[model samples]
Target chain A: MVNVAGPADKIEPSFLEVSTNKYKGILSWLLTVDHKRIGILYLFSMMTFFSVAVVFGFLIRLELIAPGRTIMGPQMYNQLFTLHGIIMIFLFIIPGLPAVFGNFFLPIMIGAKDVIFPRINLFSWYLFITGGLIAVISTMLPGGSADTGWTFYVPYSVRTTTNVIPALAAAFILGFSSILTGLNFVTTVHRMRAPGMTWFKMPLFVWGLYATAWVQILATPIIGITLALVIVERFLGVGIFDPALGGDPVLYQHLFWIYSHPAVYIMIIPAMGIVSEIIPVFARRTIFGYRFIAFSSLAIALFGSLVWAHHMFTAGMSDTAQFVFSFLTYAVSIPSAIKIFNWVSTMYKGSIQLDPPFLYVLSFIFQFSIGGFTGLMLGALSVNIHLQDTSFVVAHFHYVMFGGTGFGIFAAMHYWFPKMFGRMYNKKVATWAWAITTIGYNALYFPMFIMGYLGMPRRYYDYLPEFQPYHVASTIGSWILILGLIIMFTNLIVGMRRGKKAPANPWGGATLEWTTQSPPILENFHTIPTIEKGPYDYSQFEIPAAKEAQ
Target chain B: MFRSASNFSDNVDAVFLYIAGLSLIVLIGITVTMVYFVIRYSRKRNPVPKNIEGNLTLEILWTAIPFLLFMSMFYFGWVGYKDMRAIPADAIDIRVTARMWQWSFEYPNGVKTDTLYVPVSKAVKVDLKSMDVSHAFYVPAFRIKKDVYANKNNNLWFRSDKVGRYDIACAEYCGLNHSKMYSAVQVMEQKDFDAWFAEVSKKAGVQPTLVLQLKK
Candidate 1:
């Protein structure tokens, strides 16, 4: 059996210091097996890919500011949006929270030295970068990038003569990386918890990662094999998804969404876990319904997989298939609603701190509600007929994926910044950035709902004159959102470089990570802690002094 | 106050309003409660919190209430869908063929036109087909859309109560000019539609086939 904790050494270097000193220069990072270091590596790569995809999205929005082409032509516009979807969905959000925060915090939260397989953890990061590089490099190769949107609906995908093969190959490799990461996480959680920790005693975040790992393991291969089949059809002219041969195009849709829909849950469930973790800490109270929240994570994973056919409602399927999918879609919304109600109730009658992290959580709740409600509207068979393939679908997803998970990511950055770096970000500036980002985000996505209802389609390079105003407003909103992001990132950078030292328990968090040193030691805990209470037990501690000042 | 023209639009819009209204209430209820909780229970106001861990009654209420609410939404949606799927026996059948960047409608009398024409308040069943890749025959005013797959057979039916030109679009992304795949549904009075149908039949007979021109 492996040791739950290392030797009791009160004075030791942090993981950063030890890893850096143990090896010289870049080799220290490149060859390190520490989970925290791997997490940082994922953060840099994900952010870089995120920034590139954001520019692609910005240009797409800019080109839509007018009725006719404002910047790029039709072909270029198609390619940009396709690349945006490929990069953002594959390279960024799918692996985002789990790769970055989960890697860094999961083992630490569970009081383990590192992940069960630290070397595999490092190998996963390498696969991520290799896959990401191939995806980006394909953009410069002949035939440019794929223009089939990210769905790569067959017939069109097989028929289109772009550099789709490379993009598909990149996604296949990335799926392998994701599968390895998920397997590692599931094993680490199973075998690496501290002595006293039990199934019910685990933090909600760990449960979230556990559920997401199962999804990553189960659902990712469907997309990987499906994408590989498409590549095969493209090269060898097999009849898997080609209409010219004896294949069905709708079969490709069913297979694609089978994985992609659950992939959305994979993206958001961890974010929900982040919300569950942050709320009780900032609220200074025990979680209202811990078991409900934990079980709901599992419920979401199971139910999320069944609702994949909802994406195929407009794909010429039978009414029976449509009804079944629509009903299952509504069924999946209950767990999410249960989570939302529990989160709001947790804040009730507690000593709440209106901190930046909590503020992001608040925004997450508000935005996720809108996303959820709109999702219901889309799920409604009649409403879906009107809104399918329109800008409404586009807006609904951004609200959920970007507004919900993206905000969850920001909250984690703020909530755990001090714990990770031992430095405090400027709280006032973070607050301002949060405010601006919320305003800009709503401004950017809200009008798409209206125009989409008024009959504007999504993925259009040049729209009718009536849609010009909404597009113009959305374009301006993109500019504002980017401005806010710039300020937020810059503030984080400056704080990391020069800021006051953070306390070990800055926000008075009650998790095991809070019990450890800020920027935790080489082997997280000197002596393994025996958990006697749940993760949110606050009776033994008091709220720390306001750590607002830099 | 409404821009709807087809029979399905009212059903679609009513469901939208039903869900949207309830969602607004839930959204407002949650947001107000959240903001109020923040203000009413701040550390300054409530320094020490009472550790009320779990309430089975409240958890059950929330879970059961949303489940019930979602089922009602599902019922309304299903009712609207049943109406859409139940095609009338007297409905006129028209063949709709979608290509790379165009829509063509074939009348029962063998009259083919680039734009769709129909009599007001009369049900028209569209037999949707695609020549190459998949496209969707979408008309927002009618609140109807169905995918036009090449090797698949699909159909959509709608009856417009008002006589006006509504935009028809390909909702599914086809190649280079998917946005350019825009046509119009000209809903006319019965006599005018009959006359227009006769004129188009004569012209269609004179010309070979306009659809073949755009065919790849």
Candidate 2:
């Protein structure tokens, strides 16, 4: 075991160097119950899948660079996009922040040594990897990858000759992983907080995790049922979702969206929590409207569930159903607005540091705003009719999912890299990467809004020559985006191998995780400490004499 | 280069402009505030940070204002939608059937065509159904779309003031040749449309084989 001095006991090694299990080297990692190790394992797996999916996404964009048949045919293009969505959604973003950062920091943030059910947490990882492998394997199997898109809209899904069953099984298994992780986080938060750490006293990141856990547990089962029904219908010729068998396709839409819609929130909420956590630390101020930011997470979860029908606006639902969902979709926007306002206001009159993490947080705000506004347009009944299945929907979600949560994931990686790996990355490279990424991201997605408004439908293998210019620009933007990713990830990897040792607390301010050692000890703390003040209280760091001298 | 030929396009475009205008203002306001805060209160310029715990007034104001603003957005959207839903009494009913890779528009006089033919300045209500999977009838110029599902009837109504051709696309993803599912709405003069309908009706009786051509 590689030994390094921990914060309290100089002899104690960090969690990375030691394992609870009696094993050496790789086995120690493969079979350990340590939450931090599990988090690292998740990171490795997620990045591998993310890289693969990124190539698929890049290829998809490349194929769309011209009007007709740039590289691949329609069937291959369809399959690539489907695999990209399945891998990105099920394997990457859905379990992303919660699995990596949440698993690593949630217990420590709450002053607990480990999650309430550590083995189940590890089991969830196994399920996640297994599901991910099945999804990838389906792409290579006989009938080729599923081409019904990630939503697997019925009738089409039922009619296609693809190997959709394996993909469905992958999603179903991944749902179990998601549900179990949520169950663990919910229970851990409820029962494992340090003494005197009440509900409001917990960090906003914890609150974000708590809120997301409830969504995962409650909403994921519906998708499981929906996917299972599709598989059953495929095998038994059952009249569940297939219209030829007297079943309602719209009913399947309802059931599928019921879970999938909240699944978006599942992707974003933890990222929001990350935004909440990083803003105050870099700003060197108490977060503005802490209670509102905390409460909005719950509000998003509750109201986000009710607005699934908004996706079905053009799918032959009643007008009453239409307007009701339209209104609720608008209502959901309020909580997200509250969050953005609160994040921005946190910067006011505060000593701000333009750190790499903070830079990402700023981009998240900027891109998420575009996402939120376009989402507002889509939520409106009149505009949705025009923009529903167009490239506008494509651009809008990328702004939110990729721009918001994807950037959030990057921010967390930058913010916590030092703490996670006990090494600091090159700040100059990270900043340059961020700048390029922001420019590339906007260039890639912004044109879609205009083209979609001008009648460009999504999932078209070939488009009319009119839309070719926008597609070419977007494909070029993807190249720039990929270049930025390469630089950012390479800098991080190089820094990890050979860089300055990180301090226990690199960014100043308050949080329970920051109080521990870099890479933290086997049990996050030498002794479990009791909480006394709020998570963002910077008053302790400010001595009156020091302040007066300054 | 965008088309605004239908009655509903104006309503939809107005909503789009209203939301886009407000969103731009709000976005600018936010980005400006954030950048200003970062520059004005940089750690070098203002080392001692002020720890102001949230203002109750500001919180309530942001929440209440967005609530009102969103409610107004909902109102405008609902109004336009109501207009679209409230079909006129004298609307022409046409049957639209979508299959794997094609669309067929059957006129009221039993004249079926791959391209949708409707007279100008008329409220044409198209009843949509899917012969195979789900497909959506999307006319970008008209700013109207409705998913045509198998075994279910969904209808969309639009009135075009312009006498021109507008592109019709299958908005939903339906299997292999989905991108090739392109049709057009030929908005003709009322007299020209009547004459064309009469001529096609006579030929349609002898050519029942035309129906089989449209099916696959």
Q: Which candidate tops DockQ?
A: 2
Badly placed stretches (over 4 Å) of model 2 are A1-11, A542-550, B206-216
Candidate 2 clash pair list: none
Per-model C-alpha lDDT, please?
0.89, 0.91
Q: Which 10-residue window of candidate 2 chain A scores lowest in summed lDDT? A: A541-550
Error of 1 at B114 (Å): 0.3
Judged by whole-model lDDT over C-alpha atoms, candidate 1 comes out at: 0.89
Cα error of candidate 2 at position A392, Å: 0.6
Candidate 1: CAPRI quality band: medium
Query: Model 1, A1-550: lDDT tens per residue?
Result: 1232343334357887888346876889998899998898998899899999999999998888898878888999999999999999988999899999999999988878899999999999999999999988889998989899999998999988899999899999999899999999999999999887888888999999999999999999999999999999999887798888979999999999999999999999999999999999988888989999999999999999999988877787887899899999999999999999999999988898888999999999999999999999998998998999999999999999999999999999999898788788899899999999999999999999999999998888877887778888999999999988988999998989896777677898888888777778877888777876788988877566454443
What's the TM-score of chain A alone for every prediction?
0.97, 0.97
lDDT of 2 by residue, A296-357 (tens): 99999999999999998888898889989999999999999999999999999899888899
Query: Candidate 2 clash total?
Result: 0
* Candidate 1 to truth, TM: 0.97
